[model samples]
Target: MHCLEVNDLVHRYRNGDVVLDGVTLRIPAGSIYGFLGPNGAGKTTTLRLILGLIALQHGAISIFGLQLAAHRIDILRRVGSLIESPSLYDHLTATENLALLQAVHRVDEAKIGDVLDLVGLAGTHRKKVGEFSLGMKQRLAIAVALLHEPELLILDEPTNGLDPNGIVEMRALLTRLNRERGLTIVISSHLLAEIERLATHVGIIHRGRVLFEGTLDELQRRRRTHVALATNDDERAIALLARQSIAATIADGRIVMPAMPNTAIAQVNRRLVDAGLDVHELHTAGDDLEAIFMNLVSN
Candidate 1:
């Protein structure tokens, strides 16, 4: 069974501003699913609905094959979440904060250290949470959520305040959790590059609606092929690509062609050579999530 499922889900504010419109999704167990969208795209609202933090206006949601509403307490116990931001008592030490949550959830004290170690905050447990860096706090929040050894983890904008190194650390920690503990993760982020690096599957939402959902390969396939080319004479390469009816643009001192099939690339190279242009370099650009995202939302 899928670890989480949503069918025709809908939600709206009290003023009747629809936030999510008939969305459906399925996340298999132990996969990292990236939820991508701009601000006010209803990504957070959808997560809130799935986590039962907000009332569902329509449709169905199930976690671990159990109806969310029917088994709210039971499902939540096995689910860990770090929503928009971490919440912790400023005056309390990290360990103390975790202990408080443990007392509330009735989780074992032994699990506190285990989770802290898992998130790389083992030695800093005695430090006041207020004194922790943004990355440390984020990791601590994750450690708190993981204290109960949840099977599923949901994080909304997990890298918001993180620096480059912190983001890398968080990614590593998440990768480890998925690999070692077999945990399923649902994460939302505005950072497309980060999503591309981490997610096994992705769902892109815009204007309270999902525009695309699929594996990275499928997403890449949907994107137009873009090739970055450099010849002995840049202008010659551009002219040659243009003659072949390839949409070419100059970027970073190279001629760029929107995604094209491999055969088309060879054709471009042959055309360039025939045109007396020495092909210095010719390679397809990586499928850019930012470009794909901009294209989807612009429409």
Candidate 2:
């Protein structure tokens, strides 16, 4: 089942600036969906619309088979969100902060301990939130979100200000939450490399539209590998490759062609040699998620 679905979503600010334009997305249940885009690409706007933090202007949003318009409160009850940053009372102890959320949400106080441990912040219960590290505070925020036992968690740039170690810890924690608790998470960030490590599915948004949405494998498959070969006679090498129906282009003073198997590459090398074109260097290079993201946004 799809955990969330948004179709033809269009959102504009009161100032008349269109931020989300016909954005559509489908996130399957039990999957980690990475919502990726550059700054000002409307990623946060879409998340807010989904969570009912903002009124829906021109689109349909469905979560867990319920229409968001008619079931705003009911749907929101099943979702936990941390947008941009987690809101916390710095003066309060970790446990005290959670106690406040428990009272507001009316969640069982017993859940506090469980969530703190789940987020690796159990030992910090006596510590004031103001004294906690940024990473610890982030974890505490996640604990607050989980206090209600929501099935879906939406985080916007959860690792925005973390050090390298903090990033890794957050990634591991999210993965564990998905695996152990069966939570469906939709995380948004512009960091392609980070998402590449954690997401099973991805949606690339740019200028308020989704440019690509598919499994990580699908995105990787779309990125073609190419053989970069340096030859003494570029034109001659191109002609020789064309005679064999292989397309080639000259880039950075080297001949580049679609990647083939090792045997095929060897045959090309031999053909170039036989045609009197001296092959100097040859290697295979493939585009990564960062390259794919750049290409999509640039277009």
Candidate 1 Cα errors over 4 Å, as ranges: 226-287
Model 1, 155-224: lDDT tens digits are 9999999999999999999999999999999999988999999999899988888899888777877666
- What TM-score does candidate 1 reach? 0.87
Deviation of model 1 at 55, angstroms: 1.4
Q: Per-residue lDDT tens digits of candidate 2, residues 42-99?
A: 9999998898889899999999999999999998888988998878999998899999
- TM-scores, all candidates, are 0.87, 0.89
Question: Model 2: which ten-residue window has the lowest total lDDT?
Answer: 118-127
State residue 235's C-alpha deviation in candidate 2, in Å: 9.0
Task: Output the number of the TM-score-best candidate.
Answer: 2
Question: What is the model-wide C-alpha lDDT for candidate 2?
Answer: 0.92
Runs in model 2 deviating more than 4 A are 230-254, 260-264, 271-281
